[model samples]
Target: MKKKELIMIGLMIFSLFFGAGNLIFPPIIGKEAGTNMPITMIFFAVTAIIFPVLGIIAVAKSNGLKNLAGRVDSVFAIVFTVATYLAIGPALAMPRAGTVPFEIAIAPYLPEGSSVKTALFIYTTIFFGVVYWLSLNPNKLLDRISKITSPVFLILIFMLFLGTFIKPMGNYAQPSEIYSKNLGLQGFLDGYLTLDALAALNYGLVVVFVIKSKNIIEEGKITKTVITTGIFAGMMLFIVYMMLAHVGASSASMFPHTKNGAEILANTVRYSYGDFGGILLASIFTIACLNIGVGLTTSLSQYFNLLIKKVPYKIWATIWVIWSYILANMGLNKIMEYSVPVLLAIYPASLVLIMLALLDKWIKGNTIIYKAAVYPTVAVSIISTLDKIGISVPLLTVLAKKLPLHNADLGWISVTVVSFIVSFCIVHFSEENK
Candidate 1:
């Protein structure tokens, strides 16, 4: 592939990773982080960009998540891969991509007395219609998005970022809540909450397939290109995140009571663009969400097609698009409220899997290491996620909260490290005796 092809691949990767839910994260970080915005951004970049880039590289190096995760065993590999797909598919992400933009941009601007549900029904019908059509044509997916959708989306974002400078919001206030306490770790956890890292692991396959379709059949070359593309994509995401966070940080004093990133962004856009700003913001939201819908539906179709050999890609696309449409209409705030804790149930393990996959190149696929890392992290994650939704598991939650970094929601970090060490020692001693 030439430079142009590499650039297109980078753009396509960005488009896939740039979902409405992800976009809504950074600004709130900026708001709460306040004076610590820079520190939060550094940690945010780690969770939001570095981890996801690592995921992409791990998948590329191993050729797929299946192979990367298979070191844990076949049952784990299949189950983990499928769960990752579903979490980012109709279960959470795909639906959010369809609904968040609508809630943030379109619904806010609707005329009074108009039926919101009816309007949503009409909007999603058209939205998923485009998604289904574009997803069905996987070969043209990169071109349609990179050349058309992504550029428009980027331009709109650039305008918003630039506008913030031309007419600034006021200074950031004092840091709030956890951000006031531990900026870096708080931002890191917040970034993890975005779930983009998991998305990147799955997205690598889409980019690899796109490159293969371009006649780059050599595995080494393909993996190298994917890694480079992943870096470029990460850089792009960082830039976008920084810009959004800057907007949020600045608007903090101006809009202190604003609840979340979406509200922060909506306020900034309106302030910058005046009366017509909402329209421009709506355009940005639609383009951003539409790109995700297209990329996700296409990628999910590709994945399910390979997994379930009997089902045609078109049939899978049809099924998912319809399901996502139904979920999307359920209301974005509700979908978001539900998505986080459910994802938390899986995220710690998912991150552990990505870490193990990266280390597997050295560990040489040690199941002991995999088991050590996975088991405690998963147990902690379950207890933590349960606590998050007000479902207390009594002794477990109490014990978990006492673990170091538990207040930051990273008690599992210590668990991951200690378990790996203990497991390594046990395996080494047993093997030496043998």
Candidate 2:
């Protein structure tokens, strides 16, 4: 591909990764981080950008998530890959994307006594209709998304960032309680919660296929293209995150007690642009969410088609769009509330899998090592997630909480590391015996 095409592909990746949570996270982080914004954003980029970039590279290197997880075992490959797809697809992220714009941008303006559910139904029907159409033609994603939708989305975001500087909100407040101490770790943990890492593993196939369609057929060239595009996407995310975080920090004093990023943004935009600001913010959300909807639908459909060859891609797209549409209308907030525990359980395993994939060469791609690292990570995370949701295995939950970094929701990291070391040593001693 030419330089311009590469840039456009990068923008497509950006649009795919940039969604409702992406919009919501930075502002709250900025509100709390305040004076610590610089250090905080750097660490935030570690999980948010670096890990996700690595995930794309890892998946691309392994051909796909299933192949990467297959280093553990075939059963694990199928199970983990499917779970990751569903969690990031229609089950959670896709539905949330379909409804968030309606909640934040459209719902507030509904006529008094209007039926919110009815309005959501009409809006989502239109939303998913567009998503399904675009997703059915994944080959044209480059033209539709990278060339058109993504550029428009970027312009609107730039408008919001420019407004913040043209008319400043207020000075950043002192760091909030949670952010005052362990700022870097807090930033990493918060960024980790974005779920972009898992999305990267799934979206890597999308990026790879898009590049291959351009007739870049060599594996080495494909890997390099994907990595370059991944890094470019990460850079865009960093720039956008800084802009949003600045908006959040500058508005801290102005919008005191604002509970979430959506509220902060709505208040900031309205203050800066008045009634028209609502329209602008709404436009931003609609485009952002729509971009995500199409991206997820396309990627998920493509994967399902690959997994089950008898089913065509268009049929898979139709299935996901309908499923997501049904789920999107069943109360957006309820979907979000129920999704938390499931995502928490899967996230650590995703991270560990990515790490192992990246280190595959050095580790000699040992299945024992992969099993040691991944199994404990999932076990610890699931126990912890269950405990949080009040469904604890009493003994395991207690032991999990006592592990290092448990309070930070990262107890699994320590457990995975210990498991990996023991397994590596066992492999080495067996080799010595041989």
Candidate 3:
């Protein structure tokens, strides 16, 4: 491929990875981090930026979607592949795509006395209906809309940031309880919950499919192109995240303390550019989210078509649209709450699997060594999920409570350590047996 084309592909990949959560997360971190915003930004960027870039590189290096997860085991590969795709598709992404439009766009136009829930219900139904129709023919039109909307989203965010610098929103407030003690560490941990790294693995497959269709790269060159594109994409994410964090930090005094991230974002934009700015930000987010909905619906339909030969793409697309609309109508808060536990269960395992995929040559895929590495990874992931949902897994919770960092999020870190140690032992045992 020519240098110019590769550069364009890199930009496209970057935009694809930058979605709703990408826009919301950094600002929340900044607001909570208060005076220590810079340290928080750096920490947030590790998982939000660095890990996602690594995921994209891993996908590019692994050859294809199947190969990426196949390193662990065939059963694991299928489960991981399907679960990851679903997480990014209808299960989470689609409903989010629908909700953002309602919360950001439609809510602003309604009368002060109107019901937000009722408006959300009507808006999401229409939104997903359009999403379904457009997804019926997943062509260049979806690409065109995304290309147009992505830049608009960036521009609106830039305006918000620019507003922060031009006119201050009072001085920064005191740090929140979580941020007061271990600002950087908390910021880093929060970044993991954004789940963009998990999204990157899925988006990488789309990137590979697009590249192959264009004949820009052969099988041998796929890895190099993916890695290059991911690096370029990561750079873009870092810049955008920094800008948003700056906006959040600077405008800390404008918004009162709010438990929900969405409210904080809404208040931030309103403070920066007034009501007009808030409306504009909402419009951009809504449109960008709509494009995401189209992309996800199209992808899910194609996946189901492959899995069930008799089920047509159009039929599945319709089903996805209807289901997503129902979920979206349930409201963003509900969707987010339901999704957290599931994401907690899947993300750690997915991260471990992606890392294993990238190191496939050294590990030797699907051997006893690989299964051993995988077992501990799975064990740790289960513990992580249990902790995330506030569930006390009797044995693990007892063990965790006994540890030094037990009170904090450090229990998950301990699980991670045990996973690595167990993996090492497996590799050692396999070598000795050989």
Clash count, one per candidate? 0, 0, 0
Ranked candidates, highest lDDT first: 2, 1, 3
- Range of the 10 consecutive residues with the lowest summed lDDT in candidate 1: 330-339
Instruction: Write one digit per residue (lDDT tens) for candidate 3, span 296-411.
Output: 66656765676687999899988889888887776657776766677766776667766777667776564555566556556655675677677778787676566555454344
Candidate 2, residues 98-137, lDDT tens digits: the string is 8888899889988899999899899999999999888889
Tens digit of per-residue lDDT, candidate 1, span 1-434: 78888888899988888888777888888888888898889998888888888887778777887877787778978887888888788887778777777778889889999998998888888888988888988899889988998899888888888887889778878888788777877888888877888888788788888999999889899878988888888888888888888888899878888999889889888998887888888888888888888877877888888888899989999999999998878765676687677677777777887788777765667888888888789899889988988899979999998999887678898999999888878877888899
Best by lDDT: 2
Task: State the RMSD for candidate 3.
Answer: 3.1
Candidate order by TM-score, decreasing, is: 2, 1, 3
In TM-score terms, candidate 3 sits at 0.87
Error of 1 at 120 (Å): 0.5
User: Looking at model 3, how many pairs of residues clash?
Assistant: 0
RMSD of each: 2.1, 1.3, 3.1
Q: TM-scores for all candidates? A: 0.94, 0.97, 0.87
lDDT of 1 at 12: 90
Q: What is the C-alpha lDDT of each candidate?
A: 0.83, 0.90, 0.71
Identify the runs in model 2 with alpha carbons over 4 angstroms from their true place: none
